[model samples]
Target: MATTKSSSYHHGDLRHAVLTAALEVIATEGPGALSLRDLARRAGVSHAAPAHHFKDRTGLLTAIAAEGFDLLADALADAPDLRERGVRYVRFGVEHPAHFQVMFLPDLLRGDDAALLAARARAGGELRAGVTGMPEGGRGDDARLAGIAAWSLAHGFATLLLSENLREPVGERDPEEIFRALAELLF
Candidate 1:
C-alpha cells in the first residue's frame, strides 16, 4: 500500500521534510539529480505530496534559491567589516553548497518571482554596500567595478573551495582562514 500524502511522514511538516530531502540530494548529487518523486521518496511522503508544496522541479529550485538569498543577505548584513562580509559570503557558499550552486544559475529559476527578485536584490544591495567606497578606478564607475571585483573574488574562491579544487593548494586549511590570508592582500 502507498502512503497517503497527509499521513506518509510522521511529522506534519511535509514541506520541510521534502525540502530537506531535496537539499540532501542536491548536496550529494547536484541539482541536476533533483526530482519531485525522489524527494517524496526521501521524505517518506506520498508521490503527490511534493507537488502540493512545490508545483514542479522549477518550483522546488526557486524556493531554495529564494531562501538561500535571504540567508546570504542575513549573513552579509551581520558582518562587521569588508573582510568579514567576504568571509561570510564564502562561509554561506560552503555551508549551503546546494543553494549556492542553484542561486547563480539563473536558468534553473523563475527570474520574475517576486520573492526571488526581492531576495536577490537584498543580497546584491548588501554586497554593493560593501564596495560603494572602494578605491578601484573604473572611469567613473568605481563602485560598480568594485562590486563586480569583490563578488568575483569571493564567489570564485568559494566555488573553487566547494568543488574541492583547493584541497591541494589549501592543504586542509579552514576555508575562512585561507580566505582571510588571501583577503589581507587585497582588502
Candidate 2:
C-alpha cells in the first residue's frame, strides 16, 4: 500500500507550481474550467494555497494575460520586418492558445491590474514598431490604424486556423507559409 503526500510543493515555490498547473488545466480543459481549488488540487497543495498568490480567479487570469503580453512582445522583438512580425504574432497565438485566448477576453481578467496594463502597453508598442513608415514622432492615428489592421489580419487568421475552419482550404499547407504569402500581398 502507498500513501500520497498531502502537499508536494517545496519551499518558496508554491506559486510557480500553481501557475504551471493552471496553464496545464487551461490547455487541457479551457480557461472557463479554471478555479483555484482545481489548480490547488492539480498542484498537490492545500485548497487555500493559491490565495496566497492570487486573490481570486480574476487575479490569476490577469497574471496569465500579463505574462502572455510579455511573451508576445518577446516574440515580435527580433523580427526583421513587418511581415515577419505578423507571422510571429500568428505563430504565438497558434502555439500558446491558452494564453492567447485568455489575453483577449477582457471580461475574464482584471482590467485594473497594473502589471497587465504595462504588459499590454509593451505588446502594443512592439506591434506598432513593426509597422513601416509611421510618423517620425509619437504614434498618430494613421499609425494606430495600421497597427490595428495588422493585428486584425494576424489574429483573424490564427483564430480560423485554431478553430479548424481553414483545414480543408489550407490542406497540405503550413499556416506560417500561408501567413507569409498573405502578408506579402497585404503589406
Candidate 3:
C-alpha cells in the first residue's frame, strides 16, 4: 500500500522522492522534458513542493549531475587496477547511460554548482589516480596523458556502444569485449 506524504516536506521524504522521479524522467525523456511541475506530479506532491527541495530547474539538474559524478567516482575507486578501472568506467557509462549523458552535457547543469564541482573533482581524482598507478616509473606527464587517453576511449566507446553504432557481423565477439580489447591495444 502507498502511504501519502504530508504536505510539509520537512515531515517526510518528498525531497528524495522528487529527485528520484526527476532522474527517471530525464533518463527516459532526456533533460529537455524536465520541469519542476512534472517532477512534483510524478512524486505526488504539490507543484510548489519541489521548490522546497530544488530552488529551480537548474538546481534539480545540478543535483542529478552531481549524483552521476559521485556514482562514477565510487565505481572508479572500487577497481584495484588501472586497466580494471578503465573497464569499470566504461561499464558505468554503459549501465548508467542517462546519468552519463547528463553529467557530460554541461548546458543541462549549473557549471558553478558547488556539489557538482566537488563531485567532478572527486571523479577526476579517481581517474588521475588510476593514471598514476601505471607501473614502470609512472611518474610524469605520461600518467596524466594516460588518464586522459583512457577516459576519452572509455567514454567514446560507451557512447558508441549505447547507441549500438558498433553493431557488426555475426562473426564479431561481444561489443564490450571487442572495445576493451581495442582499449588494451591502443592505451
Candidate 4:
C-alpha cells in the first residue's frame, strides 16, 4: 500500500483523500470507528498524514461538519420554496448520510472552529430565508419563531427517515414527497 501511494503522500490531495476515506468509514461503521490511523490506511498514506490537515479526531469531525453545513446551505439555496426546502433538507440527509450523522452532533465537533461556525451560520441563514418568505408574518420574533418551526419539521422528518423509523409507515413512497405532503399539512 505504501509503495502504491508513496507519491500520494508527496503530491496528491492528501486532505481531500483522507476526508473522503473518513466519510466512507463513517458510512459503513459509524463515527465511533473513525481513527486517523484507519483513515490513513484507507487513503494509503502514512498514519500521520491525516494529522497534517485535521490535527486530531475532533478536528477531522469539525471539518466534516463544516463541509456538511456548506453542502446543506447550497441545497437549501437551490430549493424553490419553503416546502421544497423541507424536501431538499430530507433529501440532503438521505443522500449524505455520513455527513448527516456527524453534522448536527455538537459534542462530536469542535463547536467553535471558524469554518464550522461560518458554515453553520450560512446554513442557518438559508433556513431562515425560508421562513422570511412567509407573507403573513412580520419580521423579528415572528420570523424567528417560524424559522424554528420550519427547521424543526425538516430536521425531525429527516432524522426519522435516516433512522428508518419512517420506512414502514411511509412505505415505498418517495420520502421527499412524503415530507412535502407533511410540510403542506403542518405549515
Local accuracy of candidate 1 as per-residue lDDT tens digits, 1-187: 2334555466577877777777888888999999999888776776897999889999999999999999999989957666778899999998999889999989999999899999999999888877764445431455676677678889999999999999899896788988888777766
Whole-model Cα lDDT of every candidate shown, in order: 0.84, 0.83, 0.78, 0.86
Supply candidate 4's per-residue lDDT for 120: 95
Candidate 4 residue pairs in backbone clash:
none
In candidate 4, how many Å is residue 182 off? 0.5
Each prediction's total of clashing residue pairs, residues at least 3 apart in sequence or on different chains, is 0, 0, 0, 0
Ranking by lDDT: 4, 1, 2, 3
Q: Which runs of model 3 end up more than 4 angstroms from their true locations?
A: 1-11, 136-141, 169-175
- The lDDT, on a scale of 0 to 1, for candidate 3 is 0.78
Instruction: Write one digit per residue (lDDT tens) for candidate 3, span 1-187.
Output: 1124564254688877777777777767888888898777776777898898779998888888899999999999967767778788878887787788889989878999899999999999998887776774643456667777888888887787777776653136665576668777875
Angstrom error of the Cα, residue 151, model 3: value is 0.7
Give lDDT: candidate 1, residue 120: 98
Model 3: which ten-residue window has the lowest total lDDT? 1-10
Question: Which residue pairs in candidate 3 collide?
Answer: none
Relative to the true structure, candidate 2 reaches a TM of: 0.89
TM-score of each: 0.89, 0.89, 0.86, 0.92
RMSD of each: 3.4, 3.9, 3.2, 2.5
Off by over 4 Å in 2: 1-8, 132-141
